[model samples]
Target: MAQNQFSLFKQKFFSSFFITQALGALNDNIFKSALLIFIAFRAGDELGLNSDLLNNIAAGLFIIPFFLFSATAGQIAEKYEKSALIRKIKVLEIVIMALAVLGFFLNNIWFLLGILFLMGFQSSLFGPIKYSILPQHLSDKELLGGNGLVEMGTFLSIIIGTVIGGVLIGFDELGVRILSVLLLVVSACGYLASRRIPETPSAQPYLKINWNPITETWRTFQYARANRVVFLSILGISWFWFYGAVFLTQIPNFTKVSLNGNENVATMILATFSVGIGVGSALCEFLSGRKVELGLVPFGAIGMTWFALDIYFANPTSSYIGELGPSAFLSQDGAVRTLLNCAFVGIFGGFYIVPLYALVQERCDKSHLSRVIAGNNILNAFFMVIAAALAAVCLGNGMTIPQFFMLTAILNAVVAIYIFSLIPEFLMRFLIWILINTIYRVKKTGLENVPEEGACVVVCNHVSYVDALIIGGTVRRPIRFVMYHKIFKVPVLSFIFRTAKAIPIAGHKEDPELLNEAMYSIAEALDQGEVVCIFPEGKLTSDGDMNEFKSGIERIIEKTPVPVVPMALQGLWHSLFSRKKVNKFIDRLKRLRTKVTLVVAEPISPDEANREHLYTVVKELRDDKP
Candidate 1:
């Protein structure tokens, strides 16, 4: 990015925060990796510890503080300026790393373990700040891009940190001192970067810190659940961690045992996995059109499962005689397939996670965001711990690494289905939005005419029954559509309508109460500064012809009196869902992809937002042509 780039997200928010967080993540992985390598390669019977047990202990200790102190962490963030808090955390990291120097000098595993606990505590404090402060720094449109960069940076740092630790610990005589010095330098650098971050005032400065972890932890989860989608998103994110942790934990053993490879092969495996994540995380912005699209979450989940199954099947069927290096491993038939699987799993993980994090930031109440993210961190730690335990149990019972991959794949599917069913919006949006975006070369114009904030009435031509779907899917804001009750009850889409909070109406003569309720719902939604959409022509065009505009729009504006944005959907009347019947449904399917234009016009003031006026503006924007 150019230094003169005007975008805050590109120039200031992302670059500074990305460096700060990535360094923090890198330092974390450096310490953790050094400890693990020591336990695995150096500390064994001579230290009176089983290598495997020590590895498990180190991992457990690192994650335990997240579970223990996340609530307190959340509260602290909410009670102070985030930039100041981060600087303090980074300073503490420096102190911890200084002590780590002593531990290294003394060659004490127990002392390093204590420092590891403190590092975890520092990270726990950083978690809530990491996610919650995003909304403060970036606009909604920028959130996806910012998150992608952050995730990409973090994963890349993980790879770097992992590689550095393994290599440095191999240095003779000077290895311990060298590693200790590196930690202190990284920590100090992180603190310096923290000093450059823009100050983020606390969202809840008046919030009192709760001292009790037990009750406060429970309270944080309650706050997370207050927004159903936010809570579900957190669960979904944690599940990704659990799923990711399982595969990552098994990579080394899988390479050595399953593939009969050397340390080079294990390193190759981890590199492929981490690089895939970086690629995937960065791709979220392009694929999502810079919006918090939940559709990608399911897409990511499905891909994760599919590739995992492929990885399981791609595992070598026959054991080799001796350990193979990276060069030798590549000579095997399944190696390419295995690496591709790892990369795609990480890519899909990027798609899955970026959106969920953006959603949490976009949806969660600002005042409680820190606590909500804290809850998510707690759950993430819990899920990861459980995942580790489950893998141990499975492997202890003679389950092969490939079998564990299959198990995780199956579990992923089950969890995705359960969560999607509980909140059908995820699945529903995935289907509708993905399908429309795929089948239509959708061109949108005058999108800026839609108000950035506050309530508005969206009036569009009712050329097809799917008009609302197309418009709702295209518009970035959450919309409440006023639709005919019968159309609102359409199979598959009815669930979408209900989930999207589409207001269903009937003819006043047919059912006056429903119409009144629908109108009131429209007013209520507008009063809450929400977008409400309605097809002013009242019904889908019967023969590519317009219906006389109804007075319902007049009644809506009279009640809520919001700005009404006039829009036109061209080339949809000939669509399969349009009222124009095709000679054959299969033939209609032949138009699998169509060119559609959604042109929005300037917002008409409330007094002028009549049905006739809107119909005229929409028809003019449609530019009537075959």
Candidate 2:
């Protein structure tokens, strides 16, 4: 609906909600960053404790609340109207910030740690409401963009807050006073922004509340696992948090000890990473064509691992002579490479995370959506806690920070492989994505004519061997394509076809049993309410021209009687995958990045969806383009 993710800022409802959530993130990071710095620098002197031990303690304190409170929070989000609930949470933030001010003024480490726990608690309660409300407000077409904007805003706030907290907390008492006042102001502003958010009605108004965190937590995980893809998406998301926690948690020390950089240098590296994520998040709408494209997940995983491993090799040892400031650090050997690697890691991380969030929001049942998000928060916290522990164990066992980073990167690749293997959808989509983006520039028209949900048989004129992949990648839903049995078994593409659950059919002379099996499967798919795409001509054309309609489509309609949507693929005839070969060198060269179009016409009723009528519709849609 909107032109892009940026256009979301123009609407009052979206803008206000964005500001409210961003401010909340900002305040959380400011307080947490200030506390971590205090514990690292000042708390050790005052409390006579190991700074490292205290820092670990501080991290655990913040994360413990999510494990303890996320279940109850998910239920609360589901059972209440969201806007008012957000306002109340913002008010609670004001209260928490007030306590934070008292702790800062008194310079009490224990009291401040308590406030940190409370901050995490507030975040736990807000997590479900934060994500689940987007689907309620934004159209399906806008979901990816909306999530992208939110991710960008959240990361930007994180870096800004981290920088502000690090700088402000450095000035001793004056810094404490300024931070105290700033915290209250930001909290107040967040509350005011919350007040402007439009009401989001409850998804489960009559649902009973679960008070026990232990039982409710287990039940929440079950809710997440209700949909297998959604569950894997949550796991993928959690793995990202683990990867991020290891990298981000070690940055300050990584800069200080490994790079021999001062606090300012550490802040600069963190800022670079955060900014890269923001840029990547903002790029998702364009890259995914405003759809929840799972293809980007694998792409992002590869980049995250590549850049993270580069960070290890860029500076594996703490060999620098003296503590360098930001400028001097930038001038060091391999410094720019290290920073760029960090930035790309964040960039790919943004690409990895945004779509999964959108997928969870789109696929999960609305009633239990909030709870599933709560499960996500619980797992995220669990992973982060494990990351911290893993870092401690690895570093304590005589591993350098760079070695730890290398380990995390290697672990990321392993996990990505494992998850993708479990759900080949991610990899299949990635393959399709690469095929379309590299070989062709696709321009789609009338895609909205296809139904968003329910059973429908799409009739498209087949032009090339890769026609199914193009159609599958372009359409917004999963499609079970029917293809010739021999073509279905074509080596590499066979994996994609099987993963997509495509039905393979044979002619009566070739294999009558296979033909009967295919028809039954098609009927079964329609009975279960899925989109099944079939080429009415029953095979690809040798030349780029329409073929006569086959009556098999009529039998499909008679058995299932679902609405049939007509579609056409144009410009693909010239592709290398097509049977037609180009003898001219210029024509061969032009095959790369060929411009292609896929056109869809309105759905026709079953009674009118004869092979002849559908063929005419597709031919007209493809007119002058092929």
Clashing pairs in 2: none
TM for every model, in the order presented, reads: 0.94, 0.97
Give the alpha carbon lDDT tens digit for every residue of 1-626 in model 1. Answer: 22121253455656777789999999888888887887777778448778978877788888999988999999998889999999999999899989888887777889988999998889999999998888887878788877887888889999889988888887844887789889989999999888889889988888888989889999888877878889999999999999989988888888887888888788888988888888888888777666788889899999999999998899844354338988988988888889899999999989889899999999888998898889899999999989988998998898888899999999999999999998888987888668677877677898778888899999988887677778877778888899999999999889888888899999979999998898888889999999998888888777786777899999889877789999998887766677766788787886667778899999999988877778888889998664
TM-score of 1: 0.94
- CA shift of 452, model 2, Å: 1.5
- What is the lDDT, from 0 to 100, of the residue 542 in candidate 2? 88
RMSD of each: 2.7, 1.6
Best by lDDT: 2
Q: Name the weakest run of 10 consecutive residues (lDDT summed) in model 2.
A: 314-323
Give residue 524's lDDT in candidate 2 (0 to 100).
Answer: 98
How many residue pairs in model 1 have overlapping backbones? 0
Instruction: Report lDDT (Cα) of residue 513, candidate 2.
Output: 98
Q: Give the Å error, residue 496, model 1.
A: 1.9
